[model samples]
Target: MSKLLGLGIAATGLAHFAAPAAFEPVTKLAFADDIRNWTYRNGATELAIGLAIAAAPTRKAGFAGLAVYAAWLGKRVLARR
Candidate 1:
């Protein structure tokens, strides 16, 4: 399960790198002029977290990934307000 989840996350990161332009709109509101760069950085961060989860495949790793994801989600939610 962890491996699958990790792979999914990694795939998403790869998608960001593959088509940063497509993601630009999602971030344009927050990063008007730097959306592309921001997307790339986000992709890199996601890739690292995905790799970490994949390498450990332990409860700790899963929790760590979840925490990071939750933090990201919280940040996005807060930004909307």
Candidate 2:
């Protein structure tokens, strides 16, 4: 289950890099400039967390990190409305 979740998150991260334009709106929520850099940074963060979650030794910490990240993103999205 952990592996599956990790892979899913990682795939999304990869998608961010593959199609950063699609993520620009979300990036705009936190940044007014250099959106591409922010997008890449976010992608890197997700990639790291996903890799951590996939690794047994770091799975717990990764899940915790993911929870926090998700909550933060949710807040940002809501704040935009």
Candidate 3:
């Protein structure tokens, strides 16, 4: 489960760097016209989180971080709706 979640998050993080435009809509929610920069930042963040989660030594902290991150993102997305 940890591996799966970590891989999923990492994959999306890579996507952010590989195709930042794909995240413009979500990034636009907070960054407005500066979506690209925010996308890269978010990608880096996700990559770190994913790596932490994948590593046995940091799984606990990673899950906690992911919980907070997920809630924050959910709130933002919901607020937009």
Clashes of each: 0, 0, 0
Tens-place lDDT digits, model 2, residues 1-81: 999989888888888899999988888886667989989988988988998898899999999999998888778767766
lDDT of 1 by residue, 1-81 (tens): 776777677777888999988878876655555678878877786776776667664547756876977687568756866
Q: What's every prediction's RMSD, in angstroms? A: 2.6, 1.9, 1.9
User: Residue-wise lDDT of candidate 3 within 1-81, one digit each (tens)?
Assistant: 898888788888889999998988878885555679889988988988898898889988888888998788777667766
What TM-score do all the candidates reach, one by one?
Answer: 0.72, 0.80, 0.81
Candidate 3 segments exceeding 4 Å error: 75-81
Stretches of candidate 1 above 4 Å error?
29-33, 57-62
**Which candidate leads in TM-score?**
3
The clash number for model 2 is 0
Candidate 3 TM-score, C-alpha based: 0.81
Q: lDDT of each prediction vs. the true structure?
A: 0.73, 0.87, 0.84
> Global CA lDDT of candidate 3, please?
0.84
Question: Candidate 1, clashing residue pairs?
Answer: none
